[model samples]
Target chain A: MPQRQGSLDQAPTGVPLTIVRLDESDLSLKLMEMGCLPGEKLEILHRASGGDPLAIKVMEYVLGLRAREAAAVWVSWGDTPLRNLWNSQEP
Target chain B: MSLQRIFLAGNPNSGKSTLFNALTGLHHKTANFPGVTVESLQTEIELRSTGKVVLVDLPGTYSLYPQSQDEWVACQALVQAASEGIPTVVVVVVDASNLNRSLLLIHQIQELGLSMQVVLNKCDRVANPGLKGVVQWFENEMKIKALVCDARKGQGLNEVSKAFGQRLAEARSGAVSTVPGPWAASWNEVFGQGLETQNLGNEVIRAQHSAETVERYRRINQSLKTCPLHETKAKAALPNGPDRLLLHPVGGILVFVAVMALMFQALFAWASYPMDFIENMMLWAGENLRQFLEPRYPAMSHLVTKGLMPGIGGVLVFVPQIFLLFLFLVLLEESGYMARVSYLMDRNLKRIGLNGKSIVPMLGGFACAVPAIAATRNIVSWKERLSTIMILPLMSCSARLPVYALLIQFAVPEGYILGIFSLQGLTMMGLYLMGVVAAVLSALVMKFWIREKGPSYFMLEIPAYQWPVSRNLWQVPLRYCLSFVQGAGKVIVVVSLLLWFLASFGPDHKMSETLTGQATPPVLEKSYAGVLGKALEPVIMPLGFDWKIGIALVTSFAAREVFVGTMATIYGLEGDPNQDGTQLRLKERMQKDTVGGSKEPLFNRATVWSLLVFYAFALQCMSTVAATKQETRSWKWPLIQLLYLSALAYLASLAVYQWSL
Candidate 1:
């Protein structure tokens, strides 16, 4: 399955997306620990009116993330089969 | 027998503190970890089987791999305790509804090879029918006993305590096994994969950690498949009704202002009763004690009535405001609105080198800066936290209110502008606005001045709205207020005593006796304080301050509210005349006084405005300085703060005096 890749900051609200990878940075560990791992499914739930900090739903919880942190996480959004995405990326 | 230790560890917002409070039941004391500023709570609990054991509540961390100082402290304590081979039991409190994320930390602790017991907290929030299977899976596959309890309701807490007793007993007998759980195989896979990327760079190490997280989640997802536990997702979203308005751009600001207005209204309106009561009671006690002891033991009477009682009273007067401020903050935080405030204010705050989390501390500064400085602990980023602490004292705290009131009454004539606003009231508001503008400009300056220690991230957790726990409402405020009294209260008392001694006697006894025989002014003029004031007069003369105002300024360093009392005593009035008639009489006396024996009034517009500007900007409160030192754990920042604020105060007051002239 083919997918369109984008950072979480640009991802549309209420649309499901799969995390592709986290940019190598100091905050990656914190993001991963908060369940923002690759192959995890999440959706942008809401955005602040000024649009810096965003609320995203992941692992049955809503996490508030700033735009800078959201840019670190690369995600893919499409009408692709969900199960095939992780299996295809497995080492 | 020596007491065994049971260390409670968990992620933030996991109800770990709630569980600790329920287990210890108001018998815990907060103390800093050795060589670190992070505070942890410790208490003794008696189990039926085992004797009393120490229960230590570690600071919350998302993982054993440390990011912030708090996480470092938590991880270091566990590893050190383990390496020492102390008889310890680690009770991992996991949020039941967020089991997968919680297990990530559990797996990290497992790799440490410590005796661990799992307690699933907030079980009432998890709506999974396979919750039973989730506990069973922990027992069967993980080889770790799992206990379920709703810590908020105090359910299954006794059984949790019983498990702690059993674990401690086993730990004492050296029979507590650190067996490798089922997660060991996956951990081996993670480390084995990490070996290939070793020594590449710092980024590689970060990448390896990320891989480990991915692997742990993969394992958790695979293992929980048979049990099929799904956390109910219906309650996860912020309800569309309230959140719509709360997160709105314009609406959010309006709501924030309204909330802040209500808090301050409640603070000043309600706290005034207790503050007045404390002031009047202290005056009565001091007056009676002075009359009783002045005749028999003059020295003892002066020390107790003048030094000790007033010092204690000054510290006690701020308690009502501090308690109310903390109560409002705790309520906002526990109900989940505090996070939204940070979310909404992040953009505007970022422009000044701070973030949304700075709003709470900034608002808390208006009540008092001691607890407000301590409140900076919630800010994880060092630069932002330091910046927030730097500008906080500039917010025109309640201590400066009296100084501003007296000055405004003297400086501004009794008249309205246009038709509605009183001239005096507008002047008071202008002083407050000046403090705010100064704070904003200072923060802007500090933004470029302070270098970032690392990349700052705002990874806040927005939990669902829920009613705050009834017990936490009082306990949290009570804990903070007690800490304030212990930390800042000491400085106020010492400064008070030192000021009393400075004002009581002079170096030349014969000259002091000759001066004292005439009146209070002559006695005060000859005292050491009066000598020091005369010495300072030349320096402050450019700002329109005379020797007497200099004395009041020097004495008010203990606290700004002491300015009125110092003025009263300097004018031959015996006690603090806080009442209306006495204040009016003092005002009349001040109105008659002249500048340098000239016909011009001393409390003229220029001098009053200058004094108001000085009080608004000066770092006069010794308690705030002490608290800043304690919170930053260094003298460097506090020293920088005092220097910068004093410089600002001097320049600003000079400008006001010259411009008014």
Candidate 2:
């Protein structure tokens, strides 16, 4: 099945999503280097009270990014379960 | 053998600094990289076989491709060391649990062709197979030795040290060229070519670099597959239960407030005993020095006892409080909780035109603003960083602690509210909160005024929490205390001497006039500093300050805490001479000091509160202004910072004095 493409901020919390591509922005390179490259699996773990900076688990680490930066990171909803994403190695 | 220099490089949060501390113990010096505030720590390590070697710990960076100024510093140091023909061995520290990703940097460093070793630090966090296989892969495929070390536990460090020694011996014995002159030249050639191609514009080059990095990671993953490792299963989820609650929207804010309240309470209560001890010790020393010297060398004794003693004592008395403040801060940082603070503060800070990362520097500003302003380098946007630096000094640093302690004694009653909170302690906390509020308000003003055109992003990695190492707990605080003394001590002493000279000698009359015993002018009023203070008195009079306070306000621009020592010196010099060799306590002297015509004490409630308000809002630290200039690379920001904060201080003090009266 074709997957829906949207920003990581729009991705459902606690669900796994695969990063499609990080848009060409100043932060994209840093985000990519921080293990947010295309094909990497990440899940939004928590959103702060103001709902701008969200915590996402990626590369076996929890990272915090604001909604503006997260919007630059385009992701596709993953078909695999969050449990499977946890068990599988980086493809 | 000549000492070989080894560079330790790693990604941030990769246990690199922990390893450096473990290796060097107490024998290291931290200095800034040339022209940059990023600290480069170099230490001499004596290996059993290889005599002495210098280990340079570079600031952490993710890649050779520079992102921030900090990363650029690391990259430049690496490239410069390679080019300088230094007998250098590059040691790349990688997080063991995150081997595949860590290899990306190793690959970049390897291309530099310098003698290199890979340390898979934090090995204890990963499973045994993962650690062993990575080591084996590095030794066999990459032809580089890799050691699995738990820097926290000091595991596998001996092997690292021994391997380093062996590598140095081989290089010295002409078996290999550690400097790799030809390899460096070739790498530079490629780098130069890349720069030439950068006419493609920054976006294109950045995209190219990102694609290249992604490709490199893919290759690293492919290579890791051949190692004898089991399928990596995310083990025992990141001990994130505490984070969940700590990062909770409502709960997190409450916890942050509670943590800050506890921190302030500890600063006041826990530091009081040490402060009192220091104060008493200073008094005792002064009494003994005066007794010992008055009969022997009266003039010399006065210089030592009255001038130097009070100056040095003022700086020393705050050491305990400064140490405690840093101890708590270092503990928070080493435990990985500080990142959470950034996360928690990000949303609120965003409203005031700062990112989450600004919180680190803001919290750090509480200890001191010099380093705190330097710490703003990590904030990506120029606008956010500038605002953070501009407002940082408003956070009451430990330098202001002595001032507050002295003034709060007079301003607030010793009574307690609800049978628990000391009014004095509450007032201290209120002053700190007032600083924070003023800082936030000023930043809000700066946000609109200073127009920076660029996107500001906040991305922070919340590392898994670890128990802070005990040695590190003390080392960090000790380093801060030492640097504080070194940085602020010299200025305090020099200013003290200048003040002493000013307050001791009046306009030089000839020897005949002194011999004729013409009634000498009051030394303080006729002295240079007193004259200057009196000259400025008309401005400060509205805030209830006499010329004595005016003198302190002028001298304290060197540092906030100098106000205490300045007062001590002024009072020590002006006090009655035949008081049985006992100096009046500064607090008592201030309390007894009455305005010329009025019976009211000089440091009454209105004046004391006004002074507190003034200090709370003023940018009094010269070092902070210098740091702001260095960090912002502009005189404009620091000048604007000084002018606005002074205005705020004046207005605030005026309002407070009027309201209290």
Candidate 3:
């Protein structure tokens, strides 16, 4: 189900979804490449060691996204237990 | 693929990115827009069952007739694509609500006579009944396909896609592109006779317009307002009443101070616990692993505990600080408060012959200088961009957190400030304030130094306050943290390895031997790093830095935190009481360590502050240097930056040392 997590920039983090659209070049381009899409499953892998380059495993490879860009990637994360547990855990 | 390139063009804030995201899906990344100076949004998408098209998001601009670098970037992309004779279709995205304003650009695109379509973006925002005429007028006047699309809501997206394929097919069939207006044709005739030949403004004018654009401008005045349409608008409607008090000259200064204070407090207090935890964990891990290996691998054990532990520990300490600073920034930005700061600063900045936009990168640089340099790209003039780049090193990056943190702990402590607040926080505040002052003064100097004429009037889009998007706010900080760790982390690792090797062995004797001969504190100075510190004595004498401090400086070239690591490496860090994460150990070593015939503190207050000043201003990171080189497309800029920063550092430190005495 496509549920609103709060803002236009974000949806609940879960199974990777296909990239539906990219909004602006300056900000959104940075977000689009961070792995939110129309038909991809993105599991929140973990943050970069510094907790900024938010890491998500997608396309079978780990991707790093800046928080600004990550907010734009409307996602619906898969209900895998390990990924869900890590994503829900408080920073 | 049938060899077609779709160009996406629109004004800034026309929701072009949203449409690009929609069209390209997940199959694209940013690269410079071919050989030109702009970034074109290029991605692959299916057009038909067996056909594919390359979508290029052209840099958004108000008009094809260029003024700024961004506009030049867009215009150049068009010229190159047109010259290439590539099967190209231009997608002109216009904000639907401001039809006339956005259509000014679409008309210019039509003048190019290229196969094109106008995407009336943000149709969702325009509830006006005039929408039908607006779309009708666009279609009737320009004759390109018009799609009333909401890039955000996926409204009219398929129509946009259909227009893309349909336009390109028309181009392939050899249709002559549209022509310019009757008035632009007359304006060109007037300008051609008036050309002074010395002015580039005329050359740009000549190049951008079609044979009859002068007629286009003339005809524009007949129906639409001839002047630039309302210049621009707020992304989310702007508030009518100005918050003049918030942006007044004096109030802006005080506000800047308070903001600086809040940042320093967050840097110092909120980030400390995590820093302490990270430092302790690294120290503990190294110490325990050494014991596990024991006497059999004495050499290996020493390497891990001393060299590796401190090096990595030094870098990780700033991770918390980076997050905290980013958090503050994300808040300020999402709230639309930065525009106010920019607007206020612009009034003052314009005096130094620069735009207010320059302040954006300068303010943002405090978090990290690399992106600050990248931010300079938005400034149009080469002179302004270069000046911004030249002064950015002085902004004081988060790397200096270690040096400043140490200084505050030792030299300045929390106390009565006019019997009111923490003096230490004030001093910390002063250091950041010093950096800002240094940046402005340097820009002023460069203003005089570079003979290029100043920029044209500064125009800005002040986005209005809206409820801070919680998703955007959270994502912003996370993004910065990731970038810092990945970029800074790689450099930190490499530098640590080099430092580990340099500090591990000595000439003709193991590092432990040299340490043992002179070390009075058993655990304090008998490590490889300690011996290395003693060896550094002669070289750093001129600057009043001893070998220990010299090692710290060298290690910090990799990153500022490594200074602390080199200290941890040289001094015994694992509960060795003398060096137990206190300022005392460094001071004792600085004052009593025998580098000369008579003992003296390696650094007095003046020298320490000067060293603090040096860290505050210099771009010492190997990562930043590499990043600078990448950004400027040459070694010339980064090299010049290093030379000037080094000279400034040496001169500042020298003066501080001698004057203090």
Candidate 4:
């Protein structure tokens, strides 16, 4: 399916997105190590009161990243057909 | 043969510590590695077949590339062990449920060419088919031996120990290679090429590294598919449902407030009885010792009962509250609620150049800043970590509770607010809130004014919520309590005795008159401490404090809670109506006291409030200074902390005193 690339923080809550690329930053390595690799699907679970730190589920774990940090993660906005690709792979 | 040292390493929250404790039982000692403050646990275990080996549990790390100070320490220890000709075996504990992520670190360790064994911890959480496949992948594909064990339940531990014992025997017999293997060649190829490139940030180099990481994940995923591990049973969905309400904007805030309120209430109300019991025990011992020794050696007995016992008691009395605070903190961490707290607090904290992780240490500061500053290792950004450490001392710790209680009793009138709440309770709350405000403002100043050039990043994993392990819940708090007694106990005792001596002996100016028992000024007035206080009188006079209060202030630097003990000793020495010293409470003595040569009370409104304000802002505890030095790895920051906080305390106390007058 065709999709539009956007910052992860811009994606609406509850919608799934596939991480396409992470911008070069100190957090890029850490994010990648946390299973946020390119082509991995994730969903925004919830947002805090001020909508700055968003909780996202990836690789069967929830991770919290502020919007500025989330901005570095470029993700494709679309409903992933293989929604449970990462979760299904979990042992 | 000499004893072999085994290094245990793993990712954070991978149950490495649990495994270490299970293997070592209670035969373990936690000590800082060399000069660093990062704790390493060492234990001796005598295996049936392998004799005895010393197991050193290194700090948890995500990878060989260090991210935080703790990880750096772990990496350094591992490298040092390898470089030195130590007969060492490295055991990497991996999370069975998250094998791929855990394998990242395992792969790095393998490249280091150490004889390694992998313990697949938390096997109970994984399906049997998945567990079999993981074991097969490790044994067949990676050419590494693996043991499946549930460290939490102590399952498969015997097999693990046997495997380790067998491997240790093999390594000792020179059957296994302890030098760099073929994997080291590939490691050099990957990282060496990246370093040799002139354009470090070139897209080509980044793409190459990304491709390498992606290839590793692909291999891991492909290996998992080789076995018939199905997703028939759904993962437990319990925490998610409750998280909906707990993480809601309004509900979350309300719940956080309620949780904190409950914690503080327990620290104050529940801990009070134990504190009182400790106090009474100290008093009883002091009185008995005095009675037994006063006849033959009055001066020696006075020092023992009045000086040594009270000083040690003052330090021990705080143990109960500190234990309770850590009890709640450990429960929160083990249950995984602490991660959620960081998530919730991140947005607000980011404005002050901090993230959610800083909130844990700040909240911890309210209990004590020593451990709180140690907690800052979780903050990845250097700037945020420094600012957080600098502002942590402003939080009112449990040590301030006694001083505040004494002052509020004398300064604030006993009244009811709205005929429902006690005015004194409200005043106490206001003082706590004032410290928080001061901390926040100071952090803001640091964020805007302090020039720190570094990329700010915040990312944290919110682990799945689980039932708090009863063993861990108790063990952690117990360890912290023991650490407090061991670490801060010596400082408090020595300071207490020195204070006692200074308050007891004076200059020999009237030697002949004293021998004849002629009338002279009170002994305390001519004592070393009294003279020191009188010398500082001109400096503190503007804050409405007299020489005696000045003396207490100087002694209180050993620990803030010592302020109460210092006051009690001075007033007891002054000899009021209850000259026996056991009858008068500290508050009673303080209330009856009057300014010298004046009818006015010494603890007037202006003076009491000024003192409260001073203590609230001052960095009065020596232990906190020592901890700050250890954490920052320099004396400069702690020295600056002392000067800045002292200046702030002085000016703030001056304003409050002037206004109240």
Q: Which candidate is the best by lDDT?
A: 2
lDDT of 4 by residue, B1-661 (tens): 4578788899777778778767875454762211112467787898888788888888888765555666766766766565566667788998666676777777667667667899988666655623776677677877788888888877888998898887787666656654343344443343344322122334554555555566666766776566444332335332366677677777877898778767766765577789889878877877788889878776567667667776677677778887787778767776777778888888778888776888878877877787678878767777788889999999998789778867988788888767855667667777877898999888998888667555566787776666766666666666666766776677666776787767766775453443234534246788888899999999999999999999989888988888877786776566555756464555777888888868899999999999999999999998889988988778988998899899999999999999999
Q: Model 3 over residues B1-661: C-alpha lDDT tens digits?
A: 4478888887765667657765654455442211112355577788862278888777667655555555656766765565577778888887664554455566656665678877776555444523566566655655666767766556677777777778888877768466754434433342344322124344443433432332343444354542222212232321123344454457656877688787887787678789878767775776677778546666566566655666666677778887777677666754556656665565467557566667767766777776667666556566777778888878777777777876666557567757755676667777887888877887888778876553333344443454443443444455556666666667666766666666544444555653444322233334455576677867656666776677777777777766766665665442344545332333344344443445544445655776777777766777668767866667987898888888877777777667766
Q: Fnat per model, in the order given?
A: 0.72, 0.68, 0.00, 0.50
Using TM-score as the measure, what is the rank order of every candidate, best first? 2, 4, 1, 3
Q: Is candidate 2 or candidate 3 better by TM-score?
A: 2
What overall lDDT, based on C-alpha atoms, would model 1 receive against the true structure? 0.74
lDDT of 2 by residue, B154-229 (tens): 8788999987887676555545523232233433433454422212226556656767778877877788778665
Q: What are the per-model C-alpha RMSD values against the true structure?
A: 6.1, 3.9, 16.5, 4.4
Q: Which should have the higher TM-score, number 3 or number 4?
A: 4
Q: Give the TM-score of candidate 1.
A: 0.83
Error of 2 at B651 (Å): 1.7
Instruction: Rate residue B34 of model 4 by lDDT.
Output: 13
Better model by lDDT: candidate 3 vs candidate 4:
4
Candidate that would win on DockQ: 2
TM-score of each: 0.83, 0.92, 0.67, 0.88
Put down candidate 3 lDDT per residue, A1-91, tens digits, no spaces: 4332322224333333444444432233222222233434455433322233343544222343434445555544333343333221222
Q: State chain A's TM-score for model 2.
A: 0.87
**What's the CA error at residue B644 for candidate 3, in Å?**
3.3
Stretches of model 2 off by over 4 angstroms after superposition: A1-3, A88-91, B1-3, B31-37, B47-52, B169-201, B229-240, B508-522, B576-581
TM-score of 3: 0.67
